[model samples]
Target: MAPTDVNRSTAPLSPAPAGGVPGWPTGLTGLGYGGDYNPEQWPQATRLEDVEMMIEAGVNIVSVAIFAWATLEPAEGEYDFDWLDEMMDRLHAAGIRVALATATASPPPWLTARHPEVLPQLADGTVLGQGGRQSYAVTHPLFREYAIRMATVMAERYKDHPALALWHVDNEIGCHVPRDYSDAAASAFRSWLAERYGSIDALNTAWGTAFWSQRYGTFEDVLPPRAAPTYANPTQQLDFDRFSSRALLGYYQDLRDALRAITPAVPITTNFMASSGTKGMDYFDWAGDLDVISNDHYTSAENPDRHIELAFSADLTRGIAGGQPWILMEHSTSAVNWQPRNRTKAPGEMLRNSLAHVARGADSVMFFQWRQSQAGAEKFHSAMVPHAGRESDVWNNTVALGQALKDLAPVKGSTVRSRVALVLDYEAWWASELDSHPTQALRYLDQAQALYKQLWLRGVSTDVVRPGSDLSGYDLVIVPTLYLVSDSGAANVAAVAERGGTVLVTYFSGIVTPEDHVRLGGYPGAFRDLLGIRTEEFYTLQADEQVSVTGTSGDLVGTFGADLWTEKTHLAGAQAVAVYDDGALAGLPAVTRNTVGSGAAWYAATRLDEAGTAALVEAVLADAGLTGEVEAPAGVEVVRRHGSGGASFLFVINHTGTDASVKASGRELLTGAAVSGDLTVAAGAVAVVQEG
Candidate 1:
């Protein structure tokens, strides 16, 4: 696939509007890195020195004032833009772009104390105080007004600043907890219900409140659904999740809209935490208004596959942006002190991870701080200049990374034309986890992630998408853990299956509607006919219990296990590709494939390990005419993104502790190396290759 083939998966191939999101500026040709620069916390003399150090470190973008809302707007009606003006001026003079934040992360202590209604409430029903940055109630008018005013003031002040590159909305909404249950949110929740279902009667039907006599007779009768040990309502929990998500979205939208009014040319974005069970803030919905999707990613050190998770997250951001370039809003330069065990990023780990983002289609790479803080919760987090100043190993690493990025700047915002796409939906995530019937082991993200690694390891370019997206171009469409499906959604898959495209729909699919009610007819309700299967029962098997299935073809010829959520499946016209090899329910259809009009739909009745799942998906992929162009060397990952001309860039990353060999058939731009299959990529090193 070439650069022109990039939009084949996208229904709309036309360029975005002049001032709209997705339009690349003239001469914009490379990646940008550096983020969260807070000079306000440092003295003027020290701050001036820090800027020079950041430049030496390859810092091109600076995210300013994420938690300075209180300082920006000290009094209810009074506003201050003096400090911001000076900061912008200095950054512009230094040739660094700015991601001007709304500074609404934390409300002033005075405001929260003055109007207690402004505080957020935890899911456990506890009112959160002003202890963290994410304690504001979304529905509070005071909070909204103050946030909008600050955003408006900032936009107006720096609308013409040459350094103003993007607008950073209020920092990570729902990062701390759910919405408040205060009078304002309670009242707004009722209004949100009215818009979603129109009337209490309709809401009752949608939620299936008829069960357990939970039907609502009036808006006033509604409350945040809390499940106790004795009683729990899945329908209510689902609704609250939806309501909470919408509440946070409303607050974010307000700020985004306000910024749009002032600077329509610049992109507006907010960072999101990945895989946080959709407590309702759908990244899709949030992405609709953002200029560029951005996020703050900090993974646990104990996980060796943290790099893979980071890739998945970067893909999620691209998915939200509809395949446009995303920004790595924040990553730690070294070990972060916030986590229980703060471990440093190995010698070249930061560069390795940052290149992973660029390989996956990130427009920029950024960190949490430019200089280490002497105070605050993140004071101990590693920075380019640690508290020990420029004499640290961290600072040296930062300078080295900066030089490397400059060397590899040719691939910024390049396109990776992929004919393979894996579907991931937050709506499905919210619906599935909110269910009470499924086994506790039926997790959503991990399952999708497992399948993601299959394509990733194979060096196949894969895009993560939601339902209703165009699937006409891809040879293979993989939907893992699609726990919820509407009538139209099922039809979307059916269309692709009918058009000679192979489809893989996994367990926990078609279980609920968008409103979270179980589909009326049966499991996999809307898709039953297309899938040619009906499930009569599903059981929770013990951890140690095992099942095996032999593949109908390919390397998957051996048996595999079905540990949890084993669905007793009945295939109609579909053939059983694998079966449970043990237990009383043994020899059942653990995996099946139904030939639709022109293609086929594969169904997995239970979760399997990465090797097993990848084997199954690869088997299906082979039938769809999909094949990888090259096999990346061990520990050396490869990905490509395209530009306008014949220039195609490829990122080769070595994320292991030991050096690895690579066979490069194309030109390697980073090293100016000629085509070959025999080259060594140093440990934690990155090579940017290009096609001229």
Candidate 2:
């Protein structure tokens, strides 16, 4: 059949919901199905063929021109939109929407050659060359000026285009060049510090510059804490991290303003790399700028627990977006090209992964590229239409997933609710990783994930939230390794327990302020009163070190062991629920619980093993009288999404190779069959049930 004879004019493309944010183009009738499209890479004939294949697979949207600055503007003051115009018109004619990108992520070679200062400099004083994406310094005046100019030109050209659905500001801000230690960045850092601290004396006190005679007489003397003789000031390094993130955000804001000036009605967003352990930018702070939150997530094929990490990232993104539906901007259809040994997805893995994001409040599931590239750095990256063409399994799965999304149209505006909130603060992550810490083996994300995995295994829904956010709605709040706490954040946690809510404070928490300075008087400073315990000192253990612990009462009666760290704590008013049997701190309080007002606060003073952590979490959940009724097997996941008018959808996913059963009663939306009692899900399968 010829490409033109397919007749996809009647394909489902619903209008944007009336309740959606203003200026955002709507009409996405079902889950969005598409990925990045680089039409300029292929010939005109091939581009047309790609569009035909997309229509056949029910692809309704494509993000275009993300890295096309070099092609869009070949020379200074020269602009070319002829190719992009034709592609947009063709896709629009085929009933495909466009998430048009501004192409500012990578500067053109000509611009880089003309303005070499725009290149970012490493901490060792090596200037990065052009060729790679995100090579320009975000604070460079020339770079920002040219980026805004290009963005304005693109916005003016495509603001009213029929195919334009949303404006993607730039491709994954801070992905490559997150930090630049160049002179320009240093100057910008000084200006940022001045704005933050007002005067030089204030900066000195906040940074504790009085130590080691590091006090500065002027802001100009401050550098980027780059490659120092020994340990650079921890507070200075923390501030530099903050400045670099804000610098990238400033660049994004410039382009966003340029787009908004021309197309006030069009919504704008930049894709965030919300991978686990990513600390470049604090996304919680950036989420407010986006009209619709979007994130790129890629799972590590080597990790045996990648699915749990995926669920954690999705839930965190949803929480950052204020419990609103966000976009799964980029994922892989099969194997990704970046890993050491890329592995292809198992039979139903792609579908299951996409549905996992949707199950956790993602409205769209998109990939990196629409079609595989024949030449480029990412030639091996998987796509909807792989190099094997339309007959391949990836293409078939794409078609099938698109059809399934049509059946899931009712889940568009649904949201997830949780009675448990796990505080995830980026400042704490940065502060804990600073040099001269008590234990070099302590990792922020690892500890948080350990607790999150336990909660997930227990079938308890949780929202990974910022500390300053409201905590009144939650029955149980878990603060995992929150090493740095602001006064307001500390007060927020205290208020949770004061308001009759159970709060759990983990080891290595509440040790420092937001400025990376330790809280004086005692260890675990700010939380000492709330937790009813005072830590006299921290005991860092070696790699092979282990300590024996036995619960004295309630759920802690069993004997368990902990490793990595321990604290010599004195109970103020809290009762010791568990104690270390052998160690220097033997017979001391290893875990304590205190009754505060109408609620209780629990504290753990050491890193517990998986079973121990699970047991402790079980005890905390019991205290709050909150436990999930569903007791799912190891690899099975159960999630619920609530919609308007009291409608709720339950998602049961089985990640194992064998069948898994869950007690569920609802109308299965996918199969249109009534489900009651035991619902057996096949291996690597998912079931979406709508509850009455």
Candidate 3:
């Protein structure tokens, strides 16, 4: 069949106003409804059919040429933009904008075949083969040279194209090849350490080499903490992780600068993986390098609390962007291909998930690819258009979601206002997870997310912030297991309590410096003055063991179980609010509260279960003089996005199997119907109200 042409039309909606972030590219109008469009995978006739289907589904933007490196340049100096030009022109004629990717993520076979040294090496000195994507070493000079040249060529070619809306710089850095333990990596690590510590003596002192006789005579003597017979040096391993992240960031900066020099008008972004644990690169450190923040989120099908995890990732992404609206660059429409067992999404699940991202402050919702691949490693991955064509349920839901986003276009520039801030430090996460800890079961993200989940369940919006970020606007601040604390970070937490604000610090916190060295004065050494307590010893428990906690005063007047880790704490001046009921440390304080200046600081010396955590969070909320305005039913989420000049949009989402009702007054944006008094939302449905 021959390809058919179509006429161009204006965008469905208007561009969102540039929020506080200045120089934000203004090409996108309305919600962007599209995914990665790789026309190179299909025939030209099929490509035309895709455009028609995209127009039918109201997709206005598509990311193209993400992995087209081999096709874009068959030879070292060869350049070919003919096929790319045709696709761009066709999409422009169909009223669809393009997010042109640099196609430098995976270098071509020819380049790697010529220079096998570009391949990354594993910890055991095994060179990675070139069959998989992201196999090149980030520190390789030739790799950077080629990547910059490819990006520069693409930027210069598409700078003035009418369909170019945004520039996607090399897909998902540090995803597949986060670290390399080769000779090249060792040299780079030594250089990074020299810049950080200047002298070998300073490095030796920071690493505490005297304990293990691992002292380095010079920078060149240090290698990337590779696999040893026994356990590797923890401080050395931590520094290698930091160096690896910096090397990848250097590659991203090279490509970003190349694009910025050629196409200054276009916004540049690279999608970040906001997973629960450490993803090698600290997104908080990398967030500033992006013109617009974007993230790729995938829900765990096996986990029952997947929605809450999704919401956590979205909120963290928005917080990293300084509370500005971010882009949901990729999400599965149904089931993804990567998991051990891929479970399909239930009815209305897709719509609920996309709106969930928007409710948390995402301006655009997209996916990995537009059509399901017939072959490849991700052939089983679901897409906007499934294998069953336009008649499939995925297509129907896709169209419905498109219309829903069109109706909710007014939420584009609105900000999600949060009164509570939860400190998220990547450095603490890295240092706390090092080998040889008190308890390997204690994870940084798990403890932090547990408290954040409690606030979310109560319909209380909170922002995930860095440790050193400004906390003046928040009423309450929560720091969970912050093992690595710099001087400035500790001062920031103290300032929060001194300014008539409440703060909560959990167990195993403030135990180390930024260099992964223990503070040594007492446990939680950095926060002893503010918390008014000092820990004598750490009691690590087995998986099944738990200690009972009995409250003596305040809202914690009941029994709770504490597990994983416990600290024997003695209060200096603070009053004990909760005490251990049964254990060697019986009658000792498990929870303490102290007044600092005008505000108060609370410390939890042990891990608390769900109910206990919720009780503690509620008590802190009361201390901050804040409460949820609307009491929502179980499995239903309530959030508000505030626009300029007192206008607000209330998002009520029902993640339940049955219908739910809430008392509110406003006009529902989805249906344009008036909602007064009691509003009933259908099962797995969403109701966004525009309120004054």
Candidate 4:
């Protein structure tokens, strides 16, 4: 198909604003590698130099005009396109594609100055100032109109341009101001609540508004869960979180629809901040609107397990794409500028990091920027071409990785092969960590990532999926700290067990409804029947308290140390796998397993340390009839992307200070090295094997 072809895919995502399955611009081939290209920052002479350098670095595509709204529309109802037109034509002549942004990411000072009403507001009734990015209130009508106008003009201009490969919506929606609490947002929230619950009476019942004399006779009286004297209604807060996420998504859809109306053939997408740092929008709910899923992930220099978090984010993105190939829109080539301590990457860690995402299912790997900015807020942020120019290691490595991606082009469009499904529910995450929870120490991301880290360390490929996604293909489904799950979501988890698959329900799961309503029955209200266990109360351990547990048989050991949380669990029909040997909940079930139809459901009633988690994960896999090393060699991560006709590419990433070997017989695409029995990957390096 050509770049402008309308018939791109036979199976397009429903409601695809782009009219087809979102993919790389129609004609571009090979794996994409580039970053944000801001030509406006450089002089005219530098434009040619950028293209030449891009060619030298093998950059096939660059995200242009992400923050060029001020330059694109200096004044309302006024436009300028000469510079952009010249730059786009120049890039087209150089054989480079563009992910042309709508340039509406940040509103210009003039627009905001004239329409201060469009600025976002905090819950405390304080209006956010201009100066920074993402300052416009997403729900404000005036802001949308102005943003849409800019997008409409961009679409009309570049709809037929040869260099236009993809339409980039406003960059990283809801990154700074996840939700606004201004009067404009309050009106929008009221309208959203009415649409959701239909009537004021229904909203009152769902929100349990009878408490604290909060009942409302009409939806007009409702406001966003803003600052209040006491604790705001939990259900109201949850709904506001939902509404806020939806509002931002609707804003994106507004831009996307305008672009789609003009350029129906071009794929449209906005870079989603899908990592732990971002908790505003549920990308699962936002995925159907995108033609292809694109995510922006930057590992924290503060985290030692940044690579694992990167894998988690990538898997979650693949899950959002329904296991299809997706684009890695933005990541850092080296250290990021935002962190207080922006530590640089260690030698080959860059290549390993990029390929790890690819191994997880990203077909197009790009970074935050092409050139390091000399001015502005992100001047110190690392880029493919740094302030030090093309002679540095960052530049040399950038060129080498580009060629490596070109060499590994065959892996494009393939799906990651994984049998373990990890449920990641943002709604549950939001509700589970609400202010009035039993334990403020119940960190949702920490628990989920820890479980994912175990799988990542074991050389297991895991897909981070949502609650209600189809789980039939998975052999094991792990639900970690899912404190809020709907009836259907709970059923989906049960179906995994009923259909002869293994499941593990961690502590503080299945406790509340979608509306933040507690289940009437025993604890783990949603999964009592499936797991055959009941909990009376959550015995939240003190900060320094510990509980000793014993495993049954050889799997049951001397002392299974547990901390942070313990539950008083009673077995309805499940047999105890581990018992609390000491502490207030002595002799109670710490871990229990039950046979549900042909499958099994295991529940962990308390938190476990790293070693205990590894063992329990091993046991769960054993029950699922799956096997892998519970303790694999340190620092070696393996993942396989499976293509059609039984073709598979094994990615062996060695993250330690020594060389690692993997058993495989094929060609390593990274270095084109032949492998017979053991594939050796150098320290801080990666190997992609086309296995026999």
The lDDT of model 2 is 0.87
The TM-score between candidate 2 and the true structure equals 0.96
State the weakest 10-residue window (summed lDDT) of model 3: 3-12
* TM value for model 1: 0.93
lDDT tens digits, residue span 595-655, model 2 = 9989999999998888889889999999998986377898898999998888888898899
Q: Which residue pairs overlap in candidate 4's backbone?
A: 22-291, 551-556
What local distance difference test score does each model get?
0.75, 0.87, 0.86, 0.86
Task: Kindly give the stretch of ten consecutive residues in candidate 4 with the minimal lDDT sum.
Answer: 1-10
lDDT of 1 by residue, 1-692 (tens): 11111001112212344744544322234677787887778788887787777767767788898888777777777867787788888887887888888888888888888877778766567778887677777777777787787788888888888888878888878877654667667777777777777888988888787787787789888876643554457666666676777777777777776777777767777887754233347777666656567877876687778888788877777777788877778888888986777788887788888778878877777888888899988888887778877788888877887777777777765767788888887777776775455576667786788887777777778888888888888888888878787778878878888998888888888777777766766667767887889888776678787666667643356666556767888888888888777776677888888899888888888887656787886787787877664566655678878887788876778877677776555666666778665657788888776766
TM-score of each: 0.93, 0.96, 0.96, 0.96
User: What is every candidate's alpha-carbon RMSD to the true fold?
Assistant: 5.4, 6.6, 6.2, 3.9
What shift in Å separates residue 654 of candidate 4 from its native position after superposition?
Answer: 0.5
What tens-digit string does per-residue lDDT give for candidate 3 at 315-425? 899888889988888999999998999999999889989999999999888998899999898889999999888889999998898899999998889999888999988
Clashing residue pairs found in predicted model 3: none
Quote the lDDT for 403 in model 4. 91
